[model samples]
Target chain A: MKILLIEDELELATSVLDFLKSEHYLVELASDFPTAYEKAIVYEYDCLIVDINLPGGGTGLDVIRALKKLHPESAVIIISARNGVEDRIVGLDLGADDYLTKPFHLSELNARLKALLRRRHFGGSSDIVFHEIKIKPAERNVYIKENLLDLTPKEYDLLLYFLSNQHHVLRRESIAEHLLGDDADQMDDFNFIYSHIKNLRKKLIDRGCLDYVKAVYGIGYKFTDKK
Target chain B: MKLLHQTQRLFFRGVLPVFIAAGIVSFFTLRWVFDHETDEKLLGVQAEIESYVRINDTLPTFFQTVFDRWYAEPMPTGSMTNLKAYTFSDTMLFNKFENEIEPFRQLRFPVKMRGQIWMVSALTSTVEHHDLVLILAVLLVTMFGLLLLVMLWVNRIVSRQVWQPFFETLEKMRRFRLADHALLTLPPSSVEEIQELNTTLENLAYQVRQDYQTVKKFTENASHELQTPLAIIQGKVEILLQNDTLSETQAQQINIIGQSTRRMVRLNQSLLLLSKIENNQFLERKPVALKPLLEKRLVWLEDFIAEKKLELETILVEISLEINPFLAETLMTNLLTNAVKHNIQGGFLRVILNENYLIVENSAALPEASVKDLTARFARGNPHSEGVGLGLAMVVEICEQQGFGLEISFEQGIWRVQLRFRK
Candidate 1:
């Protein structure tokens, strides 16, 4: 899935970018008003993450407005440190799907992303049942044969993204960009993605559930129904 | 209840009764003196009549007794001439003594009996004419003078004594301050009414100031406490968003967290500002040039105007105002920002300044609401705008504090906000 991130901070943006690449989402980044404004108009994205205050010229609010005009079907989440009631109201009124204030936990972000994706793609259903394991979107739940699979917020989002593209190989850049946006570049390494995936797989197996997440050697991971 | 009414009520209540008592006492005393003067006059007349009776009875039976009989008759009712005819009768004095005693011709009522009647009447008129009239005049004058002296003397003494407790309490009340809830030191008074009045006033004033202080403290504490949590959340969002490798989906989720934190901060700031305005923190003031100051604001807002695609124009350049510079700047910024921020793209912003008035007119497509409500807190006429809605409210408060008059009007897609200053 192609996603656009509109953020102004450099270090934060690079870190986010690195994390999303490991999760196999195609992400594009714009650090200021003009760049973000141009990128939003030119690209097609399944989801967008935008900040309200941009450095160069316009605001993140302006970017949301432009995005809605260009691609009405695109889902958007507004991020801001403004902490003003009027700012939130203005962002939502411009057709943003959700709003978040700063200093949030990554796990919570991941959980919210999965919820939004399920609602947008599947019209809010309970389970996306693969041949081996059933992925429940409504409950942030996974199950293999009657036993429940425990997944952290990030692990759950990663599993859902892979399930939606079963049997399809996703690139490393695509995963990191999709999950972390412009923030992916800040991490010293992308090893956190391995731990998130590793833990998700371990939890399923430990619960006597089949591991459906498959590594593609040099590329990324994929969920195969034939396995 | 009020100063004037209390004065009048006490005048009638305490002073009026004392005045009435004085009047009654003097009335009875003056009546006694009047009766004594009448007794003295009656006694003097009786002594003279007795001497005349003794002189007549010893002289001779016929002549003398007849003269005595004449003197005893009540003086004739009409005039002195009729009474003289009886006193000068010829048959009473052997028929020939009538001409010899023409001296009895002037005998009068309120008779004096030491000399010839005619001679006594002439002498009385020359020495003390209308003696009875003189005595009555003297008595009336003295009685009225005594009444005035008594009224003034009583009012002075009784008013001072009766009002002493009140004046003392008032003096203490004047020294009372709200810095501390000090207990009043009331002088002991036997007057129950005055004691009650002092107690009630002291309690009322103390309670009102206490409530005011409590409300102020609550607002201060609430504003301080909210800032801590807001700062924590904002900081955490900044830290998390610094991490890499978030899917396009993960980054978007963090964005929502940041926006909520910002909203909280703005609410806290606005609340604090409102409290400061209420507490009269902007009391210190100085003269400010309004027109140039407004222009300076436009310079700061130039970038915003360009981004919003608004056109600006100014009609007048110089007008003086008296206000705190900080408050004045804040007020102008809020007004100017609202005009441009809420205006339609490519809308015109016009500012007009005169000696005592300022008007800002901008092109707007505001939702249907009364112009009066635009200055209310949290009243967002346009839901799409990203404003905290405290801008115009702050402007209204500053205008009131600085003693400026505000007027708002809308017509033909143009909105006008006018502020009038004292000359």
Candidate 2:
């Protein structure tokens, strides 16, 4: 996927760019508003991740508007430093697909971006396929070698999240947020992630599938097939 | 009493005594002067009769008007020495002309005639000062009543007109609120005191609004600034975690840092939400079926309940409330989650929801220390729990802002939280 990143903060931009590049996405960074505007108008990208607070005589909202007019097919996600709902409402009203407040997990952002793309681009054949496991997102079904694998809703979501960002360490916090949304706040819920991961691993192993879910040392989990 | 009515009542009370006292003094003064003149006229009538008898050598019986009568009685043989010269008395006389008894002031005087003194008595029946005094009293009272009525009428008109601007200012002040961002407005007035009051209030309102804006801006900018730095730290740490070159100690250190960073983020977001709720920024309302909402929320708590082996009993009726969905979710999520989080293993959790209130009662594990001030900030039920401790605080804030009643208490190791929708 080709994504245009509009950000003025060099440090945060570097981390995001490195993360996205490692995820094998063709990413371009526009550090200022004028350059972002020109690039957004000139080229067609599959997705545009625009920071709402940009420098150089313009805001990222204007760029999203102009890019959306030129290429209505391009997906847009707004990242704002403001936690206020007014700006989020305005951005959403102006045709942005999603809004992420600053200090967000890159993994969370990637999950949202993948979900938006899947809903937008793959509405007809919304299937996520791996080596042995295949998922029909529209039907909320998963199959292994023409045999249905009975999975709970949370387990299915966990497997899909791992598939979306394979080989990257997914923190327990990010997983909880993805699964629970606003209900993730105000308490520690590490036990739920642990129990769910254990059950999912057991179910898959019993079905003679390779263990793709790996737990990092004192960190979180990663999906990798390498020995 | 209304201000105008109270003033009128005080003035009415003050004016009555002076009016009564003035009428009494005037009546007495008129009566005293009238009596002196009547006495002089009676003596003069007696002198004329004596002069006529002496000059003509007989009693003068020429003529008499209808209201006047006179008589000459011969003095007794030697009784003239006992009666000095003159005597006067008021008598009731029966007049054949008028049938009713008439009051007469009479005087008796001695007239020497042929060595025997002729005693003469003159009576005047036209003494009408009693009726005159009564007429004067009635006139005085009538004038006082007219004066009081005119004063009351004038006072009513004056107060209604003059206090108009003050009432208008009061109404405008009552309607002024910071949430609407409307400036205070006042109607102009010609009265100096009222005009000054309006200006002062307008100035005060302007100052209050300016201060409010400043506080609001500061909160937004502060949150923004803090969030950016925290984002940078969080992003850098997230990127650093992707590497596979860290020692065990380093990994542990990073894990600690990450945990603290996430906790900070939650704290920041919670504080911001609290401020927004207090500012009355969330005013959108929609009718919601609370039974389904709570049922769904309870499903999210299934994992936690199963983990602690809690027994949750929920009795939700079909109750509809007009509220912002975000607030309802927050309040319920906090209450439901806290109940489960703090409960004992195999303990009972009972949630009863009716039209009036929502009650959540749960048994606790090792809750010997009384959890006082549960809704205060950072006052956790468990001192070592991983919560940021603003959960119940946020619930309390939303309840207060939305005019809901909240009662939280811990008794005999059972914690109960009651949220009342109706007062």
Candidate 3:
């Protein structure tokens, strides 16, 4: 998906740019207020990542408000070091689809961006039809031959990770680390991972879906299509 | 700080004194007028009686002549002493004379002639004169009542009218919140002092609002400008990390960039949050159920509670108060976070909730310092402490904005933060 990230912090902007580019998103960056404002008005983006503090003539909030007025179809996400609930609320009030505070990991931003994209553009339907099973990103809706199945947000994220990384042996530690982010290291156990996998497996089985989420046991869970 | 409050105080301070002084002066003046009028009337009566005595043999002869002339009959000899002995009659002279000297009660004259005392009393003493005196007393009382009413009414009207512009200036100042337009529009008044006051307050409010706006804009611009370069530098480091030729030392450099970037991000966040609070952007308020929300937050912090090895105590009562829910939550969170964040490993968290008040007390490892600066942004006891200092400041802002009262006290090394809701 095409996205524009308007931020004044060079390092943060570049880091975000690199991450999105690596993720194969068509990403464009603007380091100052006027440049970003000019670019936003000129080009139509699927989504916009804006920072509240902007350089040059205009504010990030102003940009959001102006852009939303111009392009109502495009989803907007506010990324700011302003962790004040007031700022978040104001951004939200100004038609931002989501707000992410600074000091956030790229993965978390990506997750939030993906969530917003799905909600704004894809009607929040994260269902990927792969032969016999359909996977929904949000609502954790899983369907096999037209039968619906329930999955939690985390469980759904985990399944999507597996699907994206099919044919690869996902390490348990890496999976846990990625799933919980910085908070994973504080925990003494990863048993919750196994329990989630088991539940997903059972739910799929009960729904009469094929066994694709294979466990590496000591390592991680993987999704493989052997048809 | 509000204009209304300031004016009310000023009314007590400035204009109130003037009214009180005026009232004291008027009171003395009224007493003097009454005394002078009474003295003049008494002297006049004494002069007229002395002249009548000089003109006639005695009061009895004078009274008897008047009786004969007015009623065409010789009065009984002792009837003059018993002035009230006459029967009832309807006449205008009696009414006019009664009205004129009605207040004079006992100014009778006793004459000595041929070694016999002729005790001559007023013919109208028990009837006409008594009634006249009663009417005069009533007239005096009525005059006094009218004077008092006029004085009070005039006092109220004058005080109110004179202070009208003052109150208007106060109202304009009151409506000046940080979020709204700060340009003050003071009402014009005829009084020089009041006009001067309005102009001065108008200027002050305008200056304050202007300064606030400038600072707000600066904060917004500064943070925005800083983010881009920081983002770019971080991005470049990541790009370098993707190179296979990078050594451990180089990787460490990238890691440093990452850490500092994180810190910058946090610092920027705190700055922005503080600015927002100062700007009063989050002022939307509504009634929120306090008990359930507090319970839920405490439940979420159960993990942190477990890690700290602190004992949790709750004494929440069901109460609902009007406030911004988010700010209320932030206020509670900051209190809890500070309590937990600063506490000793095996310390205790004591939470007490009563009607219109909530108190959170916790034990800390660091010795208690004066918590007077608790509500100031970045005013932590320890500079290196993890807290951003905006927590309590935000709490204070929310409390002020929502009309809630906040009190902070340290007792026996226990830092106590109390939130008192306006009853």
Quote the positional error of residue A160 for candidate 1 in Å: 34
Per-residue lDDT, model 3, residue B121, is 32
Residue-level lDDT tens digits of model 3 in B1-423 = 954456456544665466556555655565556545544443454455446655663442334332222112233355445453122322223335335422222323443333344433332223433344456555655665566557656656777777777777777777777666546778788899988888888788778878878989898779756755555554464455544465657656665675466456555655665566666666787888888877876764555676678999999898887777776776776678678777777889999988869999998865434576666766777776644566677777777777788888777768888888882
TM per candidate: 0.39, 0.68, 0.52
The predicted structure with the larger TM-score, 1 or 2, is 2
Ranking by TM-score: 2, 3, 1
Cα lDDT tens digits for candidate 1, B1-423: 754446556655765566556656655565456444433443444445545545763212223322222223333343344443111111212324344421111222334233322211100111122234456556655665676567656765677788889889889889765433456667877899998987787788778777877886787668756754564554455445444455555655664565555555656666776667766766678888887788877875554566557888898867667788768877777778778776787899998889878899999986456777777887777765555677788888888777789887888889888998862
lDDT of 2 by residue, B162-267 (tens): 8878888888888887655678889989999999999999899999889987887677667657887788888877777777787767766776787788888888
Per-residue CA lDDT of candidate 3, range A25-82, in tens?
9999887888888888889999999988887988899888778878988889888865
lDDT of 2: 0.83
The lowest-lDDT stretch of 10 consecutive residues in candidate 2 chain B is B365-374
Output the worst ten-in-a-row residue range by lDDT, candidate 1 chain B.
Answer: B118-127
TM-score pick, better of 1 and 3: 3
Model 1's CAPRI class is incorrect
> By the lDDT metric, which is better: model 1 or model 2?
2
Q: How many clashing pairs per prediction, in order?
A: 71, 0, 33
